[model samples]
Target: MLDVAINHAVVIDTEKSVEKKINIGIKDGKVVLLTTDTLIATRVIEAKNLIASPGFIDVHGHVDGYAYSGELSACQGITTTVGGNCGLSPVDIADFFARQMRDGFVINQAELIGHSFSLRQAVGIADPYRQASPEEFAAMEQLTRTALQAGACGVSFGLDYSPGASFVEITALANVCAEFNRVMPIHTRLFTQNDLYSLFEVLAVAKRTGVRLLISHFVYQYGTGIMEEALQIIDQAIENGIDVKIDSGMYTDWTTFIGTATFDEQTIADNEMRFSDMVVASGKYLGKRLDRELYLKMRKHYPNESVICFMGNKAEIYTALKKSYAMPSTDIGTYKKGEGHPQIAGSFPKYFKEMVKERGDLSLIEAVTKATLLPAKTFGFAHKGVIKVGSDADITLFDFEHLKDNADFPDRGKPDAKPTGIEYVLVNGTLAVDQGGFTGEKAGRIIRV
Candidate 1:
């Protein structure tokens, strides 16, 4: 008998533009069969009104094995999450993976070796305004190589967070990733509002070093009404044979810590961002918009607390996601239930609610493909992100008609609220969430490069 079987479900074939009613059988954490006839299994689910698709893979998240964050991710139907994004990750990649293996986790995790913050700190370079010395560059290269050998998926750079990071440091790190046949995910520098040049700089890296580049949060970088032009530049780069791709969150606004260099007075003035446009999402000032006094208090006292900046254009968010090359991601991190940006819990559901159900910008099959196969192909995760025989049995069953995101920003309600209409989520053929509630099972594994 099969380990698990989902019956009478509408299977979304992401590779093909079709959805057919079928039964899927799983055993040994792999898909065993797909057919219209009844299947015998040790555990069977009757999914009469649900759409069964390959499990969602979040390509850009900061959930580095925090249990609360993983619970939020699993609730959104994400079976695998690529964490260690945006210049912050645990320095000991092997030890982090080992801890996950030992303690068990709710979702599969693949991590990137972060530059700017993690690596610089590892080598005792505390000043974000000064370039690394030649000696420091050599040391960082050695650490990167070690992490790659320990199964890091790639190298990530949050250039805006470390303005002093020079071209030499970035190119050197890119060379190491190239040698390992790994991709580089860049959170590009935003010199000002409408900074298309930042996007160009990352594209130039791909052009110069032949490294596969995944631009993090395209909308946040170019959402000031320049998405079309930014996408054209990416298209031109792709025509030139440089492998460039991007991932974007569903919303226009982006969140980060209050103490980062990005929130410095000079950086804020340079970007033309007003303190009034920022809201404190965590800690003592939760749900309050930042005034000069509160901003100073948070900056000095609660430096690590998160703040959401009400910037970027909504139109640009939809426009950037319209590109077939863009995959949906949640910039999720560890936060309390009622504190954090709604994007942490609502991104994927909002993607479907807006793109497929309401506006019709993308077909159901196309949206699923972007969320599944596209990221898997980009990152070279071999066994995940497709619904095929022998593929890993990570799947999501949801009701298309009734699905909606309940989480809103901190001022509204709980950002970690579980979405509605996600009926069941299976990770490694084990029920992680059943009938829209968590099953208290941690069936996830650490996926190495």
Candidate 2:
């Protein structure tokens, strides 16, 4: 008998964009069959009147194996997440993977060895305002090589958080990532919300280095009414034969550590962002908007805490995601159950709701493809993001009609309210979330890319 099976389901064939009714059988953690013939299993799930698609893959996140973050991701029908994004991650990539592999997690994790924070900090570079010395740059390059050899998905840079990072440092690291053919996900620096020069710098890096570049959180960076122009640049780059991909989340607002260089007094003024525009998303100040006094206190005492910046043009979200190369991402960070940005719990469902069902901007097949197959192909996960025989048995079954995001801004309500209509999520043939809830299976594994 098969280990698990789902019967009477309309499987979403992402590659072909066809819905084929079949019974899928899983054994040994792989898709053993997809046929109409009778199949028996140790456990069978009745998927009648449901659509079975490859489980969603979050292409950009910062879950990093934190328990609450992992549970929240699984709850949204995500089976795999790429962590260590935005230049913050554990320094010991191998040990982190080993620990997660041995202990098991609720969702599969692929990681990028972060450059702006983890590696720089490891090499004793303490100030974000200072560029790395030649010796320090060489040391960082070596650490990146070690991490990539140890199975990290790629190298990630958060230039906005580390404004002092030089072009020399970036290109050197990009060359290393290119040498290994690993992805280079960058959160670009910004002098203003409309500054396109930052985007140009990254495009130049791709042109110069021949590395596959992933512009992380496209909407967050450019959704301030500049997405049209930003996308034009990306399109032109592609036209010029540069390999560039993008990922964006549902909401227009962005969240980040309150202490980053992006929040330096002068930097904040340069962006024209107001203190009132910031709302604490986590920690003791949760749900409070930042006034001058509160901002001062938070910056001084709780600088590491995260805050949501309400500074995006909502319409730009649709414009950005309409690009064929753009994929949905959560940008989720570590937070307690009740104390984080809504994206942690709401991103996928919200993406499906706004981009697909509500706006009609994307067809269902197209939406699922961006959330699934696109990232799998980007990261070279051969067995994932497909619903064929012999593919890894990772799938999502949702109630499309009822699927929506319930999580709201911290001030509006619970930012982490669980989403609706994710009925079942499978990882490696094991049910991780069943009937809109966690099943305590913890079937996740560390995926080496």
* Model 2, total clashes: 0
Worst 10 residues of 2 by lDDT: 434-443
**Residue 337 alpha-carbon offset, candidate 2, angstroms:** 1.3
Off by over 4 Å in 1: none
Put down candidate 2 lDDT per residue, 48-157, tens digits, no spaces: 87779899999999999898899999999899999999888888899999999888898999999999988889999889989999999999999999999999999999
The clash numbers for all candidates, in the given order, read 0, 0
Q: RMSDs, each prediction?
A: 1.0, 0.9
Mind sharing the TM-score for model 2? 0.99
Tens digits of per-residue lDDT for model 1 on 72-166?
Answer: 88888999999989889988899999999999988899999999899999999998988999999999999999999999999999998999998
